[model samples]
Target: HTGNEWGTENRAELCFPQLFNTSCKKPTTPLSQVLLFHILMPSMSLLTVTLNLLVIIAVSHFRQLHTPTNILLLSLAAADFLIGLLFMPGEILRNTVCWFLGQLTCSLYNYISFVVTSASVGDMVLISVDRYVAICDPLHYPTRITERRVKVCVCLCWLCSVFYCYMIVRDDLSQPGKHNSCFGECIIFVEFIAGFVDLVLSFIIPVTVIVFLYMRVFVVAVSQARAMRSQVTAVTLQLSVTLTAKKSELKAARTLGVLVLVFLICFCPYYIVSLFGDEFLNSASASIVFYFFLLNSCLNPLIYAMFYPWFRKAVKLIMTLQILNASTYK
Candidate 1:
């Protein structure tokens, strides 16, 4: 019934992979590529979905966890949630060589993917900027980047994201053969520009700013730690007791340093691949690089677990409660 409907056919084909019996024709894909594209993709899709959802629940259930930093985390979790729930599943289904969800759903799917993913990346950049301000400009940080500024930044991020998504959706469905399967095809100019912009604004610019700000913070903090150690020695000599002076400051500095390092590890791969693909790689290579972006969602929760004690505690508690509840019901 939907031979010309790319969206519907694509979703149906992917959702029920066994049902789609059409095998490859030209230049058969290698077994390794098949495994990577079909099996690994679906597994990672489900894993990413579950992890991101957990992040959302972990943050949401803990009322004490509603600081500005976590608010940004929550926003990121939301973005990842949409990508997992709506985009990955839908796109995976589409990849299997059919579209079964009809034209309207196809358009909506594309829109949600762009908007949610873009918003998530934007949130990360904003968070880095927030940390930079907090660390490098401590005395005036509160005044410079207030609660109101955060709210405005978040609001504007979503607004711009929605606008970008709208453009994509419009471009998808507004073509000459609106009902044809090809309408679901990506817009190259839009995607290329978007990728370039995201690579710069989302990762490069933010990281540069973060590095510069943290360098200043590092120097100041090191000096302060030395001064604190001297003061502690004077007091300890006077009273003949030990003090853990500057311990928390040193810890905080180390934590921030580690955080920047992890952020670099998680983001740099995707952007590096992105820049390389845009400049020289073919479509297939670029597509693989694009999938690497999903790895960030997987790594993000891990980062939070490593760095945030509250997040780790909440995850453990929630898992325990679920286990007990399941046994009780059993």
Candidate 2:
């Protein structure tokens, strides 16, 4: 909301200086910060797109990798891929400079961002439930979480994401850029009540499900470890087994530590700020926070795909061109 008077004749400083009081003044973002973002964000986006692409390819191309869990990962990786491919570059432009793209683009941007983010969240909940069932109810896991069921659930997740985000951004779509206080700035303001409901339904409820399921999975895993420990016969053998088991438990604890830390670090601030109002969403600092939240999408492949040995093998095959050669020979 800074004045064009301070901006002088600098069209660079004000998005549209000729409009005077109505023009959106660019935030006093430092050159170094903007330059750094210009360099880093695209690189992050490229890496995210590449890694997630590999995950998608690996899952799709290999028969051995076509499991229920991999299907969910593939769905999540696609969501991440879209974020990297579409949203990150757009955010770099929209946040780092004046948005010259106009209101229609802005509306579409917000809508797609919401849909992708919602799908990503839904995929996370699915992954958690998958793990919970696999670990806590191993016998039923095969029957309960078949590939057909996972595919159907994935399709439903995307469909629901599209429908739900439409509900959130419908008003803005009906009247393009209604929330923008000044020309050239892009902002989407959900009604406070609508935003609150979105917070509850899209974020809070799903995150609670993920956390609870993971906690339950953790408990089941621990109980299984104890059961294994109890099965050891000799005292010395039990001592050795106990030490190895303790090490494994410690490793699992560290992984869970990373999971909780990443979840809280990536998600909490964005939603916490959202809960207050879109006023914060309009601020420059909050744009940075929004970018930080988007960062979780980039990290997701690492968290979900990198842990699996099959993924590693798949990557190796793809990278070495073995898969291509195999296809050619076939």
Candidate 3:
């Protein structure tokens, strides 16, 4: 009777009954929860992929859309695109089923996740700086923020992200599954020292820069808007063009402000959870917060669509396959 009871328990609990003693137990979630995740995760993944792809195509295919600012946006869209394509699906599978891809694959997945996320954060900082210069120093903006310089910055951002993430997860890369106690479990734990360093580099520093730059940008933008409104004179061609340019800059600042604000809203919770300890990392609440982080990649493109008429027009062109024409870029 004891043998039968033991067998039943193993059959019910173990992810692999054949390796019962070595395998991790399957997570026992309510049927309703499983159903909810199935519906929610896949939908988020699909939307993230689709929306970021549109941004990529819109920026890349249109000649008129290629500017220093859009180049920064292109880099951002590329990082978000990778997040949707690679990380989101892996996360959904990890939560929904057993880890069957083995330890090396798991380590690689974690490495790529870190690289893409870091790149996205770096891109946000660049965008903030771009807007800062455009709004705060409009006379020098053309010389200061050129496409060639922006391209160089974008390249450096990606290269640094790769190097930084490798440094963070170097131990996991060297010895995959060292932290896992069972065959079906895939886990990576950054020691407290490493986690603290990551918190400083990844969260604390970037958030500080973004907030500071955008705060300055907000003050300058508001003042510029008021100046533009109050300085109305006879509509000479030069004055008309100047007012139009100021209005455009103000609108751009407001849109990118929304992007940065949404990023903070989504990102802060996950890092705050990380601050508590490694124990919180594996909890169900942490999983939910992690999804919130991933949700930012989806929100970005939607923000673009809402704010940018060019993005809407570009989407229409791409959807109709009009971009395939050689003259579309012209």
- Per-model TM-score, in order, reads 0.69, 0.84, 0.95
**Per-residue lDDT of model 2, residues 154-193, tens digit only:** 9999999999999988999899988888888887689877
Score candidate 1 by lDDT: 0.62
Whole-model lDDT, candidate 3? Answer: 0.88
How good is model 2 by TM-score? Answer: 0.84
Tens-digit lDDT track of model 3 for 1-330: 699997997777888888877888886655655644587767888898999999998888788888998998899999988998989898876777788899899999999999999999999999999999999999999999999999999999999999999999999999999988888766657878888999999999999999999999999988888888787865789988999999999999999999999999999999999998877876665777887888999999999999999899888878898888734554
Best-first order by lDDT: 3, 2, 1
List the pairs of residues colliding in candidate 3: none
Off by over 4 Å in 3: 1-5, 30-32
Highest-scoring model, lDDT: 3
Model 2 CA lDDT for position 313: 75
lDDT of each: 0.62, 0.79, 0.88
- Encode model 1's per-residue lDDT on 1-330: one tens digit a residue: 666586555645352434344322122345545765687767777777877777787766766665566677777777876776776666556554445555666667666776887787677667766665555555576688765677788889999989866764565556422534243332222356666766666667767876776777678677766766677647446333323424543554566466556656665776686576433432454546556666566666777778778777777767787633422211
Model 1 misses residue 117 by how many Å? 2.6
